[model samples]
Target chain A: MKVAVVKYNAGNVQSVIYALQRLGVNPLHTEDQQEIRTADKVIFPGQGEASSAMDYLRSKGLDQVLTSLTQPFLGICIGLQLMCRHSEEGDTDCLGIFDLEVKRFKVHQHGFKVPHMGWNRLETDNSQLFQAVENPFMYYVHSYYAEVGIETTGITDYILPFSGALQKDNYYAVQAHPEKSSDAGQTILTNFLNI
Target chain B: MLTKRIIPCLDIKNGRTVKGINFVSLVDAGDPVEQAAIYSDAGADELVFLDITATLENRKTLVELVRKVASKINIPFTVGGGISQKEHVSELLNAGADKVSVNSAAVRDPQLIDRLAASFGSQCIVVAIDSRYIEGHDIVHTHGGSRPTELETMAWAQEVERRGAGEILLTSMDHDGTKKGFACDLTRKMSTTLTIPVIASGGGGSAAHFEEVFNGGKADAALAASIFHFHEVDIMDLKKELQAANIPMRI
Candidate 1:
């Protein structure tokens, strides 16, 4: 299976590439339209500011390419956020693959940090993404989270219940870093690969 | 519930993992890549690689080592020591480091935190503060705790967080290598003070010490070296104890 990770001025793709390699697949890390479009699976993993990432993606004309790709495209972290209608990070408009709006985590108290950074359990996962695994631990490091809605395939509680994973048609994305996540994360990647 | 993170910090000197007693008397632990793999497989939440001798000449070598370990392990790895410039941060992040920790650089140029946070996003910039109590006040130290600065530890931590650092990797120079336990009291203060995650580093002797840091220290993460490096404490066993003690862990 040909796997290609979307690369731009967004975030780090090395861990995602390494994760795929451990699964015995040497995936291509590229921003090339043809390479990304032609790949059997395209993993869009990003970890930077949403507006800046969108600017880079639009500048490289990847915005259209990403939205149009019919194959299984997995968006991680900011990738998942960018797939929404808009983000509060920079008040920037996004790809709108899913009719979603990304909001910052509601820090309830003083020590309630913006970025919910650490390992947290995944609850209520019925998608193929959670295949071979029950509610498990996944590493999350982000301030913005997708609100649970119709497209929410999984729900997680941090400051409040939010979409842990979103699925709409061929577009699949998760707020957690499945690559940085341990064994269960690898299983999610494996399941995506099988998809 | 946030799972308390157990991070194994590897002090690197001349491209080799070394452990120090009270920030001095360096001893070789093993190869960086090999030790990193062992920790990752042993269920360490995150791994920290600090170049003890972070000279300009050896920095390139550290990035190379980071790539080697990042390719092998599937967990978040933070690299620090002698990271001064934006380019150094980019080099480490490009080399597969999930986060780039800056200590003296951030203290010297406070705006460095803003620049890094702006450029790479606040999620990847970690401001490491090596501190020791001098007289009656906690003072921040630089260059591996050899020099004490006028900046107060808590004050500096607050400044760094306000300047947009993702997390504070706070190491208590006073309690480091003591093997007695972590500085839980101050750690709890820092954790309560900062809205961001405070990784309590130093003076981890056993699982009980970790428990104290998590409960009293209220630290989001705890990093230790000698105990884990010399096999005095195993990561899996430590997690078992922490789990049994009602500390939420990834066990």
Candidate 2:
């Protein structure tokens, strides 16, 4: 399969590319609209600020290209947040693919840490992306999360219950890093590839 | 629920592991990439590679090692040691390291934390604090805990957090290498004081020490080098023990 990873000014795209290579798929890492549009699948993976990332996307005209794509697209971490309607980080607007708002974790108590940085179990629905995975734990490192909504397919509890995985038609997004999530995450990526 | 993390730290010198590791599955124990893969497959939540390469020429080797490890290992890993500049962090992150830990450099220039956090998001910035209790005070130390600093341990940790550090890696010099146990009191103080997750490093001898650090120390995660490198405590077996003790582990 010809997979195109939407690249911008974000970090950790190399790891995504490596993960796909481990799965026997050499994904093309590109921000070019034509390459991304023509690919069989597109993976939007990143780790960076929302406003700066949105700015880069607009500068490259990827925002429009990404929103208009009809192929199966996967968004990871910041990619998932940027796919939402808005983000609390930098108070920037995002692509309205999921129709959800990304809110920062409020540390009301002492034990509740921001950037919920560790492994957490997922409460998943019947989404095809989670076909064989059963409430598996995934690696998470983020302060802001997409609030659980209609597109929500998986929920993970930290300070509050947030959307772990979201699916709406062809657009699929996950708040955690599936590339670094070990076996269960590899399964999710494989499922996405097969889709 | 967010589970407690078990991190196996590897010290690297010129792109090779410094300490000898006794993993039967590993062909070359000095290979950080192979060791990291073993840890990941054995249920380690994350891995940390502290590049101790002294010469500037060997720095390229660290980046290459990071690239190799990121390609081979599936779990998240952090690359630390002598990382002071934004350019250095940019290179390592571009090479595919999930997080980068800053130690003595962060202590030298406090604003470095802010600059790094602004340039690269806070999620990738980890401030490693090495402290030793001296005359009823927890004082921060630099250069592998050999040089003493004026900053207090708790105060420095809080400062880094306020300056936008995503996490704190606290290492107690007194407990380290003792093999008695982790500094539960100091770790608990940092964990309760800061809103960021604390990874307690130092004296981790047995699985019970991990349970103590997680429950009593209130550390979000625990890191150890010798005990893991020497095979005194197996990662999987240690995690099972922690799980049996009602401590949440990946296993």
Candidate 3:
């Protein structure tokens, strides 16, 4: 399958490429609109702060490019948050593909860490990504979370229940790094690839 | 209701996983890619690969190695070592690294933290602080614990967060690889003070050690190397213990 990974100043693009490679797909990494438009599946992956990452995306006109994608698009971590309507990190404006807001977890009474790093159980009734995995735990490393809404396909809890994964028609976004997660992580990618 | 995270870090040199006590007296741990898969099966929360070599040969081969691991495993993986620039961070992230850690670089140019966080987004930037107990002062270590900086660990952590660091991987040089236990006081002090989540690294000998880091240290996550590599403790078993301890864990 031909996969197009959106390239920006953020991290985790190569890991997504490698993940595709294991599935026998050496996906092309590019910021080119034509290439991205023509690809079978497009993945927008990132690791970085929100506002500036979005700034780069806008500077490159990638924000517009991403918003125009018709094929199935998967956004990872920051990519997923950027796909939302807004974010609390750096007061960033994001692509409004999914009608969700990315908000920071406020300091709570439990005294839990804010970033919510490491592996957490993924609870979802949607079998598309969780197929054969049976609610497996996936790797995560983030401070901000996408507020739960209609498009949420998976849910994980930190200080509260947040959008671990969101799917709205052709656009699919996951706050977790499927490239970094294990078999269940691969399954989500495989499912997205198939979609 | 988030499941507590258990991380296993592997120090990679020339693509091989190596372990040492007190960050010295190195020994072979295993193949990094293989170990990563093992950790995946055992339900590790995430894996961290620190390219400690900083060598031409190792650096050249490390990206490809990371690609190999990312392709096979479904979990998130973070890479550290020799990262300083935006392009380097871009390259590593593009190479399948979920996050790229900035240590010495962040210390040298604090703006580099802002640059990276602004470029990649704070979620992608990690400020790894190696710290030690100064008789009366809280100090941060640099150059992989070979040099000391005047920056206080807690103060630096606050600055790191302000500078746009998404998270802090706090490793205690005094406790690292000591296998005695985590620096509870240090971790608690930072955990309580910093707004961001802290991954406590160093001095984990058993499942109990993980508990100490989580409960006593109040760490969001606990990271270790040798204990996991040598099978001194199993990831699933450890998580089970943590779960039984009434600490929420992903089973």
Candidate 4:
């Protein structure tokens, strides 16, 4: 399978490469429009500030290229935040693939941390992603979460039932890091590949 | 609820796993690549590999080791020891490290933290503090815990957070290999003082010790090496015990 990992001014794409390699596929990491356009599966994984990333994307004109793709695309972490309508992170607008607004996790909530790091299970029932996957805990590392909306496929509760995974048409994005999330996370990747 | 993380740290020297008692008397433990895969499958939330290599050739060997380990494990991986610049971090990240920790260098040049956070984002930069409590005060020590810096522990943590560090890997030199327990007081102080996650490292002996650090220490995550490296404690069993104690663990 021809897989193209979207390359941008984001951190931690090496883990994505390792994730794909474990599944017996060596994906091509690229920023070229043609390489991303002609892939069987595209993964938009990132770990960085949304505002600066959006700036880089606009500079390289990847925003249009990402939104125009028809292939099965997966967005992870900052990638999901950037696919929304707008983010409160830096008052920056996103690609609008999913009509949802991203909000920061509220502070002063007793003793809980802000970034919501580490692993948590998915209280979701989507067969396409969770099929045959018994344990559903996946790694998450973010301060902002997309509010659960109509197209929400996976839901997790930190302060509220936020959208852990969103699916609309050909675009599917997850707030969790499947690459670093162990066995169940790999299963989610396999399910996406099968689709 | 966010689950508490149990991380097993590997002290690597020249591509081999080594262990020590209170930072001395190094002994060969096993293969790092094999140990990493075993820990991941056995339910370790994350893994840290501290490259204690001295020569440039050994540093190159560590990179190859990281590549081999990343290909097998499916969890968060953090690499530390002798990381001095943004270029070193980039090389490790390019070799499949999820996070790169800067210790002595960060203490020597505090501006290195800002530069790394700017280039790789705060989420990618981790400021590791090796601290020793003495004279009724906690003092920060760098240079493999042999030298003391003028900075205090709490003040350094505040500064690291202010300079945009994603996390702080706080290792208590006094309690590191003693395995009595984590420095609960220090861990709680740092966790409450900082907005970012605090990974409590050193002096993890038993499952109850993990409980003490997570509950009394208020640590976001607890890390240990000796107990995990010698099979004295299993990660799964430790999680079960912590879960039964009403601590939220990723089981």
Number of the top-ranking candidate, with DockQ as the measure: 2
Chain A TM-score across all models, in listed order: 0.96, 0.98, 0.95, 0.97
What lDDT tens digits, residue by residue, belong to model 3 across residues B1-251? 66768888988888877663221222333567767777777888778999998666666688788777876777776899978888778767666677788899889889999998766767678889998888888788889988899899888999999998977899988888789998888888888887777889989998888888888889888898888777788788998988999998877
Worst 10 residues of 2 chain B by lDDT: B51-60
| lDDT for residue B90 in candidate 2, whole number 0-100 | 93
TM-score of 1: 0.95
Which stretches of model 4 miss by more than 4 angstroms? B20-29
Q: Would you list the C-alpha lDDT of every candidate in the order shown?
A: 0.89, 0.92, 0.81, 0.88
- Which scores better on TM-score, 2 or 4? 2
TM-score of chain A of 3: 0.95
Question: TM-score of each candidate?
Answer: 0.95, 0.98, 0.84, 0.95
lDDT of 2 by residue, B1-251 (tens): 89999999999999999989987778998998888888888888999999876457877999999999999988999999998899999999989999999999999999999999988889889999999999999999998788999999999999999998999999999999999999999999999988889999999999889999999999999999988887899899999899999998887
TM-score of chain B of 4: 0.94
Of 2 and 3, which scores higher on TM-score? 2
Tell how far residue A14 is off in model 3, in angstroms: 1.8
Candidate 2 residue lDDT tens string, A36-127:
99999999999988999999999999999999989999999999999999999999999999999999999986688888899999889867
In model 4, pairs of residues that clash are none
Residue B71, model 2: Cα distance from true site in angstroms: 0.3
- How does the DockQ of candidate 4 come out? 0.74
- The digit string of per-residue lDDT tens for model 4 on A1-195 reads 999999998886888898898899999999989999999999999998888989998898899999999999999999999999999989989999989999999876767767788898777766586687778899998889999899898899997889999988889999999998898899999998988
Clashes of each: 0, 0, 25, 0
lDDT for model 3 comes to 0.81
Residue A13, candidate 4: Cα error in Å is 0.8
